[model samples]
Target: MIYRIAMHNLSNPSDAEDIVQEVSLALLTKCPDDKDDIAVKHWLIRVTINKCKSFHRQFWQRKRESIDDYLHLEAPHQRGVMDEVLELPKKERNIIYLYYYERYSIRDIAEILHINANTVSSHLQRARKKLKSILTEGGTYHD
Candidate 1:
């Protein structure tokens, strides 16, 4: 699950491993003793995703001297079109990662994110359009 989240976010193996460990520790510490089996699992997954988002935010908040240097240094080694896909807005990026990388159905994503399925679908649509545009345009090409 952590692997999937990391891959979907930026395809960074180390980041994914870190998230997995973070999530595991969080579960160990924060998991409610009285929660049911399903609830425990759900809580773990939710926290895992939040951790991935946190990691992304932290990475983006760095004080790099040059944008190009930052991109070159921070870009994760991912599969085809990863750079393009991540160029989409954060909401779109999260929706796509949840659906594709995490293998969550629309309903599952909605439940996980506490949003409606329609909203999830809308984000997915927008993400797809943004991704297609990025790829067709041959990358966002930020300098």
Candidate 2:
């Protein structure tokens, strides 16, 4: 899950794997042991987001990496939709992934992304429109 999130945002498999490693290390050394299942998942999602944000702002971002890594993480059937989702800007992409793929509610997405619920809603709507247009252009969308 973390890898998928990182890959979508970074567009590089190696960097996504790096994110997964960092998150795993943090979970081992820093995550609270008392948290429940859902709480742990949220914690992971937050840490992954922070790591990806940090990654984007750092010097290491200059190195070229490939999307080849993404091919194995997702099922064959999901590849098409995921390719379209990757067209979205990072914010909307994250929201879309969390909402549809991770099955989080709008409120949960708001909390996860540290924005208001209304903002999340607006982004989701906008992202849906953009994805629809992209899919329609590809001749895959239907009413």
TM-score of each: 0.61, 0.81
Off by over 4 Å in 2: 68-80, 133-143
Could you tell me the C-alpha RMSD of candidate 2 in Å? 4.1
Worst 10 residues of 1 by lDDT: 62-71
lDDT of 2 by residue, 46-140 (tens): 89988999998897576764454446645665666667788788889898789876878899988877899999989888998978754355554
lDDT for model 2 comes to: 0.82
Error of 2 at 128 (Å): 0.2
**What TM-score would you give candidate 1 relative to the actual structure?**
0.61
Q: Count the backbone clashes (under 3 Å) in each candidate.
A: 0, 0
Best by lDDT: 2
* TM-score of candidate 2 versus the correct structure, residues matched by position: 0.81
C-alpha lDDT of residue 77 in model 1 = 45
